[model samples]
Target: MPKFTGYVSDHTKFIEELKSKTPGMEERQQEGRSLLWDKLPISLDEEARTRESRLRQNAYPYQNKF
Candidate 1:
């Protein structure tokens, strides 16, 4: 076997250490990611409305477009 450097070789042990230090760590991580990053699809009508709104911004707002 090669000499062990400071870097970790055992990934499972590392995860165990994290789980032990923080209770409900994995479950909370899943929930937080779902709340912030997970994308649910909007309704087709909502999507069409958004697309229609985008078509209205022809000029930059700084030009005082009415």
Candidate 2:
């Protein structure tokens, strides 16, 4: 059997230490999510109208230069 080094043991110990240090971490994460990431979905009709529906591309993109 191959003996693994202290990396895995050290990582587990670090995680336990962090959990003990931070209380209510999950609740805080949820509160942050509600404040920042919670949003209503908007229609994409305006986007579709503003952009070209057809795909466009140059055959050789590298040849073009300003």
Candidate 3:
């Protein structure tokens, strides 16, 4: 009988292969994440300005006021 080694899941194996094939993928992913999600905290004044700059939408927009 052989000593049981650590088991690697199929998904993990695939990811490892993908990383080997594409270098700098992790850096690009980080850059994309920063562009879409990583953001600076906004000040209270900025939040208030953003809230104040929006126009209210009417309910049942398709129906005419007439």
Overall lDDT per candidate, in order of appearance: 0.85, 0.80, 0.96
After superposition, candidate 2 runs with Cα above 4 Å error = 1-12, 43-66
Models ranked on TM-score: 3, 1, 2
Supply candidate 1's per-residue lDDT for 38: 97
Which parts of model 3 have CA positions greater than 4 angstroms off? Answer: 1-5
Q: What is residue 7's positional error in candidate 2, in angstroms?
A: 6.5
Write down the TM-score of every candidate. Answer: 0.54, 0.37, 0.84
Per-residue lDDT for 48 in model 1? Answer: 93
Clash number for each model: 0, 0, 0
Model 1: CA > 4 A from native: 1-8, 55-66
- Residues 29-48, model 3: lDDT tens digits: 99999999999999999999
In the range 1-66, model 1's lDDT, one tens digit per residue, is 898667675887788898999999899999999999998989999999898888465466568645
Looking at model 1, residue 15 earns an lDDT score of 89
Clash pairs detected, candidate 2: none
The TM-score leader among the candidates is: 3
- Which is superior by lDDT, 1 or 3? 3
The local lDDT score (0 to 100) that residue 56 gets in candidate 2 is 77
